[model samples]
Target: MNRREVLAGAGTAAITSLAGCGGVSGLFARPTPEGVYVPDHVEGMEMVGTATLGDVRVGLTYSYPHRFWTVERDGDGYGTSRVDIADDDTVHLMAVPWDPETELVLPNTGLSVAIRTQGELVSQEVIYPMLSQRMGFHYGANFPLDGDGTYEVTVSVGGLSIPRYGGYEGRFDGAAEATIPFEFSADALSAIPYRQLDERRFQPGAVDPMSMDAVPTGVAPDPLPGSQLGRGTSGDAVFLGSVVTADRFGPDPYLAVSARTPYNGLVIPGAGLSASVEGSGPVRLDAAIDPELGFHYGRAVPGLTPASDVEVAVDVPPQVARHVGYETAFLEMPSFTLDAE
Candidate 1:
């Protein structure tokens, strides 16, 4: 896990649709179970602080591998107010509820949360990746990640008058820096076996080590469009489409990604696709990352605004420049949905 290589922000793919307006009441609404909401505290790990305001209860916990912390409402399903650590120095908040009253982030990340209240002083501190930028009552920023040091990251949700952090270390992968900020969750626990991505998700071959070009390596994609990446002979999981196998790391961390220009930015990110980690869990769609890009601005399309609609994911992990559009475009595959049995 290389944090600096892929610390990302929300993708602004759909900025134009919102006319560059995000965090508005209905600018980017999503579906959720309707009810009078009340926040809940999570149990386990190191409980930091808990506070309740305007019917909203918030708490913090210290997270490490093998520990669990969750957040829930009186009647809401359970999850956690979690900070997750990726392979590198990348850090993220998880299971944080998205309030309709809050504003939207368009398509900045694979997922986006809204702050619903402007003068509403809601604040949460995080681990790695400094956050320090705010747009109006909305907040967001990009922080860099390094696989080295330990650091502090704080995320405060107040008015957009306050700023969210941005680009921690200018987005570089495999950087040797100590960047321990945010918290940690399950995703930060381990390399989730492909099969366990979902329930009843079946797959063949090794986890994160599928075959491509009739060779063995990372989630290998088909060399030719019609080729096969894996054969699901072990269980039921299938390698939906081409996969990105092997990563050649480097100095010019972010360079260029192009499908037409082979080898330079070669990666197959099967979109809408799914793969199960054979023996353990459900099928989940994943794309191989470019260690160079390091999940920062490599995929940044100029002019992308705050309201662009993008996939529901953590900040885009960094990849060298070679990761730019190759996955999103070239390896266009169907998303893998959990076939719960």
Candidate 2:
């Protein structure tokens, strides 16, 4: 219920604290403290929280384990062992088990640390086992799309594990995203770096296709990369005006605000504006509005109605003209610019 708590849980910045320090603050901070957490004190990295929405106070916890274990009956006696934690988005933890006598080198106690999600799991060869290397990292995907579902996030390191279910319990407009805290450390909440897993991250040391995989996909696109999206000014965009200029619009009349802008990409309403891509591509059309401003369709894509008073300024951009099928609507400007009120 506190503004500071809301800010901490919602921002993308990493929390600075030490994991396994055995407290609330350490469990939720960036740059976890040294010598705080050990192999014996992990419940598998869990995220726990309490909240009250209206009259309903949410008191719940979710848990996940890095690896599952099944007991095998050996002639009436049972033995417990490790099971696989697959799926790429598996959560990982940093457990530096130093020699009990000394407190620096690594230990080979048949235990390791890891994080897990619904997608995949990354293992030990990638996660060095030692106190000499003591920085933790997190990777996440399958981000919650709506505020009506639950997610299982688990962290396991040095035989101890913690699990917590992060949930969404409200409605939100605009582009949706939220920050989920980690059980081992708060940095886990915001340290999830989003990189295309299936595609190449970058070029390989100035090498060409021979040394690596750099061949272009076969089906050639019409226009090469870096081509101008369209002609004319971007402020002069057009769309089918949903509201009537005189409060009596009969048919869905289209309005072109920007004189010309046609590119193959996105047109986020609040993000300045995005023109068409390849003349025809996917666009995220929204209708959230601000009464004082133009009908806010989004950051880039905007406007609820056509400019009834603003006159046409210039010839339509060829790309815009062709894409909107507006060849006949091209009328030279009698008053090139809009008059200020």
Candidate 3:
């Protein structure tokens, strides 16, 4: 079987086992009292609102306060630890930023949110870029509200630190903010669907991403534009390589690599990457967005040919927080050689 088929089969088997009661060991058969671990599945969250800010469309959602994990730098690699929900935690706020045209979720956006009532700031925080089984990739954090009342949520999106290409050039560079009013009440928060898994509460696999009404679930597009080089996997993150020549990217050939999650094809951003062509030395690839390629890492390579032997190295793993099934992957990725088409 092909690599993608193998990955799909493995994921399916694991998820099936997780849904059953027979395969889980005694250690993980029960749910944790505190801290974050894998769960069977989380139901869909209710949308707070959505607004357009420059090139980005931000959607906000909320769920019951959750105990989640955070990723931090650890030596040469990275590490994950739990963030307990505080006693005063009222809701888990999530922000999803995406390209308005393509609906592809944007990463490394450096999102910050402020909650206010009666023109007085109540709470504020810089949310974490995170991954989850249901939400895919988004910016989220636990927050305490000022009880039930009318509140104004101001979401501020910072400039894109990564490079931009194609129609994305010079865009998302300036910070933009949007405020949406919301009615917060215990009745509305309690109405959100919440379900606990029976035996799969702490199992090894992930549930499917939740289908929201108008929000993008962070999935990358398949069959990317340009000449297909081939596909490879590193650290359970799938990488698709392609070459494209465009007037916007200059005269040389541009190499684009799209990194994504395995089954769901959610874009993985905020990674440091480099590419080498025919042992000609490494070229640092900048995390970029394009009209056709979506979210990818790319750099112009002079004298790039179809026969060039290309290798991609992950200098830094995705610097975003992970939910459960994703925490173990996208770290410790090995450099992989692309098979030229």
Candidate 4:
């Protein structure tokens, strides 16, 4: 299995949505009875410190890969490509619940946590953990670390309601905060071996490699209709659509997507959409309601250049009001090189 398969096999994709704000509360409301079982310590991970705030106890582990890999922009967020950890690379902050009895894998109460370090506030989100299966929960974030030194990490967790499985509907009193210190050294980082997938678990021909051409594409309608890129598969019966930006240095490329099924194409508005070009900074594709097309459109600013190859990744939220859209995974387009105008 490649990195994508390995990551996907590790566990279920994390649901990052808020209640009421979008209609995501009900989608993942029911929790699985099978709890997560994760190991306490690994050979390479250094135990920094442990603290108990309220009901939840947190253990911070510090570790880095021998050779870092960059995420491939080709539609697959779980997939990876070759890239170096720059001088200011993000330090992996893995948060594991210290209590053996408590399953912190999926917090049903909308509990959200974030880390403050290096004068930055990093929100805790779904991060692929080391020894994915052995790590039960998805509570970690990548923070920037400058060179070798000691850094203070502060964790703050709070939510309005208690976990649904706990059989509580009242306000929760488990809000708490804890700070821990971590040290980093270049020598220690270099000594760490690369985390490789088990060769025995590798099943040849189990899954096909990711290809850009594999994604379905179409053309925009009427007037200045341009080449359109789309992913038909999404949450439930919803379909996503976008306009593959024309190769020009003018307006940034835009993607117009709506939550609709093939049978019913009623435009689902207010859905968030963002795109990123590999190596380049994040391209802001703001949402614009297109009544004519019956879909919400987001145009990329400061567009792209032609003849140069680029990989674009599109992220669509799972819930768009009542309409269920795509999951947490990104839709990666093939390496696109525009024809000379």
Candidate 5:
């Protein structure tokens, strides 16, 4: 079987295990059921530190080098390939940035990292926004580090590229940087829990996302305000639609669709989406950030009634990169009609 098939199966099996149980809690809980299949449960990560850059608060952390995948546009959808751990790979570096005021994790922020020691550059690369069984949505990548010592890690965050709404206007529009010291050693890296699944390793289930005290997992707001259109699933990702009339969205009634992972509800950004009402033809939905809606795709529609037949299509899948559990999902998505119940 291909890698995606293997991971999907594994996730299914893991999630099924949580059927009757009260549901596991804690950061290191095993067999953590998720919406998608994930490989094994990785242990904790050592927080390198956190810094404030512009309107974003970035938290840096590290764990054992992990094998992940890189995403690329594949025809109308997307594709992914495994990126195995290199022989010299030292740690899987992660940068989690969020809006401090809103306390929401920021996606598509164009994040990059540069590691240095003794005034010399050690490693640098533009990290990918990833979803993991441990950390739901964050920017991360594996890096080869020099032998154990204190290193100055500088994280650079770029401006907001997507449309902003509500209180998010005119914010996160400037580039910012921050530096923090990280002490790395072989012993420290080895101490982080690393377990390989046996019978359930390749099963069709996913472990639950770990509880992180340092950084909040980027999740879409539940109970999205406005008249509820309905909920549906496409390509294992859940989509929820609602209609709201607001001055910010102009005179037309706005149709908002929140696309997220199934169980964890993490936001899926960088997607090309379109919607049609009562077979009124497709209308492009722009990626938007709002105070109440969080991250969603929406547009102002002239006539949207509660009984309107709405169909939302994933014209292009999410453009963000993926970790093990999410590599195969959010692609090959079919259109789903929104039930205005």
Candidate 6:
């Protein structure tokens, strides 16, 4: 089978698995938990849970409409559509230690985190203190609410030894767990700006074609074909040049290219961009903006070899949106490679 077909089959398999884990029906079926803590003092993120594991403190922060994952659906009679699902409402878990003088964050290698929901566990991406925000070293990942209910979050830290300072040293070799509850409301999801971009294209002054009322109530229709979802940030003044590659995309491989537009100084998800690889197979692909990732990506490229020459070209077209806060911009997607891992 061709590469696209392989990705389609894999996506179909994924949809089948997601169906049992509360795909669309979960939106209305789950009830909000009682006395949900809306902690105003913790950097605007609602503190879901926190625990003291040894001498270190680990905390979790969650928000809505944060990250997204999408699935492709086969159409019965109508044409196929890429069905977008907001699986990852953003989640951030941070770790810090108490000290007589100040808080000391741990090295990224010192700790790891994972969350359990609906019997599935996903590992969090560990960010070192220096790379992430100051004093906010974290193990972070976004989660899709399978159904309204509590999820078990586990923060595991291995034996970590800190150097002696002022007559004291520290170490942690345990795990902490917390139960986090969620309320899934289609109404609340409707308020997010990007949710409006789920299925439709951007047009000036045009009404959103996929209203919340139009969303499926029973089983979600098959995700539309070639749908893309991602998240990224460039603020409103900086342009970031980026490149990404994948060793595999379900028996196949991929090379994605993207760059931030000077207009608005950001990468706009859902915008269609063109890409090409210059090497054997010389694949030419279209990269789609994934607003959830805030970047454009090409997930399935055919016949990519590790020895392929390192040249990826991306063409980002000018975007003009008078209604929204955007205008025409251009991008110079940088060149990069990903060694097999």
Best-fitting candidate, scored by TM-score:
5
Where does candidate 6 have its weakest 10-residue lDDT segment? 214-223
How should the candidates be ordered by TM-score, best one leading? Answer: 5, 3, 4, 6, 1, 2
lDDT of 2 at 341: 26
Better of 4 and 5 by TM-score: 5
User: Which scores greater on TM-score, model 2 or model 4?
Assistant: 4
TM-score of 2: 0.17
The local lDDT score (0 to 100) that residue 140 gets in candidate 1 is 23
**Model 4 poorest 10 in a row by lDDT:** 208-217
RMSD of 6: 19.1
lDDT tens digits, residues 180-276, model 6? 4444443333332222122222322122112122111111111111221122222221222223342223455544444332221222332334333
How well does each candidate superpose onto the true structure, as a TM-score?
0.18, 0.17, 0.85, 0.36, 0.86, 0.31
State the displacement of the C-alpha of residue 161, model 1, in Å, after optimal TM-score superposition: 14
The TM-score measured for candidate 1 stands at 0.18
Which is the better candidate, 3 or 5, if ranked by TM-score?
Answer: 5
Which tens-of-lDDT digit does each residue in 190-255 have in candidate 3? 666544456755654556788887788877767768878777889888898988888988999999
Report residue 339 deviation for candidate 2 (angstroms).
Answer: 21
Ten-residue segment with the worst summed lDDT in candidate 3? 18-27
Q: Model 3: residues >4 Å from true position, as ranges?
A: 1-38, 196-205
Give the residue spans of candidate 2 off by over 4 A.
1-231, 235-249, 256-264, 271-341
lDDT of 1 by residue, 6-82 (tens): 12222344323322221111123433222211111111223223332221122222222211122222233222232
**What are the lDDT figures for the candidates, one per model?**
0.22, 0.24, 0.77, 0.36, 0.78, 0.32
Residues 1-341, candidate 2: write the lDDT tens digits: 22134336644432233221211223333332221121211222222433222221221222221332222333543332333334332233332222122111111222322233344432222232211001110111111111222333332223211110111112111121112233432344334322111121121111111110111111112221111122232222322212222212123332222221122111212122222322333244232322111222222322323233322222221111010011112122122322222
Residues 5-53 of candidate 5 have per-residue lDDT tens digits of 3334457655454332211111125552333675644456788999999
Can you list the residue pairs that collide in candidate 3? Answer: none
Judged by lDDT against the true structure, how good is candidate 1? Answer: 0.22
CA RMSD of all predictions: 22.6, 25.6, 8.4, 19.5, 7.9, 19.1
Give the local distance difference test score of model 6: 0.32
Count of clashes, each model: 94, 59, 0, 9, 17, 21
Q: Is candidate 4 or candidate 5 better by lDDT?
A: 5
